[model samples]
Target: MEILPADLQLYLETHCDIEPEALKKINRDTYLKILKPHMLSGHYQGRLLSMLSKMMAPSRILEVGTFTGYATICLAEGLTETGFIDTIEINAELEELLNQHFKSTNVEKKIRLHIGPAAQIIAGFDGPPLDLVFIDADKKNNLLYFALVLEKVRPGGLIIIDNVLWKGKVYGDAQDTDTKLIRELNDSIAANPQVEKLILPVRDGLLLIRKK
Candidate 1:
């Protein structure tokens, strides 16, 4: 899953801005309390998300997958004074742990946690046009999630999809279902004239698309 060499990854982490205390706790707690800790965005990618969120200064943000809320906290850091984030997670068991961390950091106020089927929940999603959206949920539904959020995003808004590379499995023939979907999503984004896209080899892979 790590595309970068250990030394280089360490160097990159070492050179980046110090990880915030709140995010540090999320990073630590997720590893300790959660079942697939690797799924949490971790320090490097968390910082990347935070950087992008701050740069965008989005008024409204939508996070399609909220695993232990690591990225949720990171993204919330960059919200405008009145900005808010709606983060959805499929696992109901994580609701308490997520809220606990959010409350501990006071980010709970800026985040609205929704627990249930992401697609169904997204179907009812309504608010100001989203200025930023991060989709890191079910791999198979990547296309569906993209379609659901595309029109809701403001022009020039960003949609960042994680794991686009699928551990390099997307490079050639997609032998599995998830790989095929991710590959298809990548191709679909590349072909779409409605958005400008780039795939940053950060962590697994981050496919960044901006609505045109």
Candidate 2:
């Protein structure tokens, strides 16, 4: 249920910046070997994530979903030399596949994959406040995850949420439960005074929030 026209999508891809050589390979391989290849953030969004990460130079990052590890790797690009990224993926079935690709990349040391419910796993970590948090897991628990991580993210840190647009169904006549939930989450972020938010039209929709 893509909201963008085919021509526009193609144009966006063509005109936007491309990913690095390693990311290019990972992106291609994920599509060919992964079950839900579309979940992999492609060139445009990947580049955006990488650029944001680089700009922030975060010491610690929290990724709520690691669907094939594409976005995880992208976010890791901006970490400090000794920094780390704690990424969670509920699907244990993709563990071997994700590990295989992760091992093949240089950022493997920086990414720690946790296989289980994100909320529960994140609750157990007693590490330093996260410099960046990317939420792309279950839509129904978006707000829950946000609340759980709110304290974990330091002031001025970034929290990025994906699929906020829900294929533009948020503004349409009617939407399924997931779409409605996403719309609600967007509104919740918009109304929250503790953070500054910006919703970008990048692939699907990405909400960038800076904790205050």
Candidate 3:
């Protein structure tokens, strides 16, 4: 379920700021080598992440999934001078590739890659108060991740969850486990009094939650 037609998507990309050269290479390499290349947030979504980060101007960012480190870089673009991003990726196989990609960018030092289950790592995260979080990891654990990170987010901080639309499966009969979990998380967030939320029909979908 493409919210925008291919032609329109391309047109928007053309008009937006050009993607960083390093990101462009990573996008190409991801499609060529990764099993689920679509998981990588490409041009439009990457720029969206960057734009949101810039708007927030967060001092600390947490990324639950670092697939190819594309979105990680995008989010880090708006970090304050002394800020850093702690990104967790479950697949150990991607560690080397992720590091290699990071090394090619100036933001390398600002990104700390943690290769392991995000749940466990997040459970022990005692870093600086988080000003922004990007949750794009396991769908089944979306609720748990939101709970774990909510308190850590400074009041008025943002938590952006990707794939909430789950390719529009969230709208129709969602028999799959992942889709069901996403819907549950969406509903729970909507009803929760702790945060302000909105769903954006970006790439797959992005649920933005601002901690109150």
Q: Would you estimate the TM-scores of all the predictions?
A: 0.96, 0.94, 0.96
**What's model 1's overall lDDT?**
0.91
Q: Judged by TM-score, which candidate is best?
A: 3
Best by lDDT: 3
The superposed Cα distance between candidate 1 and the true structure at residue 142, in angstroms, equals 0.7
In model 2, which regions exceed 4 Å deviation?
1-3
Residue 65 lDDT, candidate 3, scale 0-100: 89
> If the candidates were sorted by their TM-score against the true structure, best first, what order would they fall in?
3, 1, 2
For 16-135, candidate 1 gives per-residue lDDT tens digits of 988888888888887777777889887788899999999999999999999888899899999999999999999999888988888878667999999999999989988689999999
**Residue 166, model 2: Cα distance from true site in angstroms:** 0.5
- The predicted structure with the larger lDDT, 2 or 3, is 3
RMSD of each: 1.3, 1.6, 1.4
**lDDT for each candidate structure:** 0.91, 0.89, 0.92
Tens-place lDDT digits, model 2, residues 1-212: 33467788778778877667777888888878777677778777888898999999999999998988889999998999999999999999989988987887789999999999999998898878999999999899999999999989999999999989877788797668888898889999999999999999887899999999
Clashes of 2: 0
Task: Report RMSD for candidate 2.
Answer: 1.6
The residue-level lDDT of candidate 2 at 195 comes to 99
After superposing candidate 1, which stretches have Cα over 4 Å from the reference? Answer: 1-4
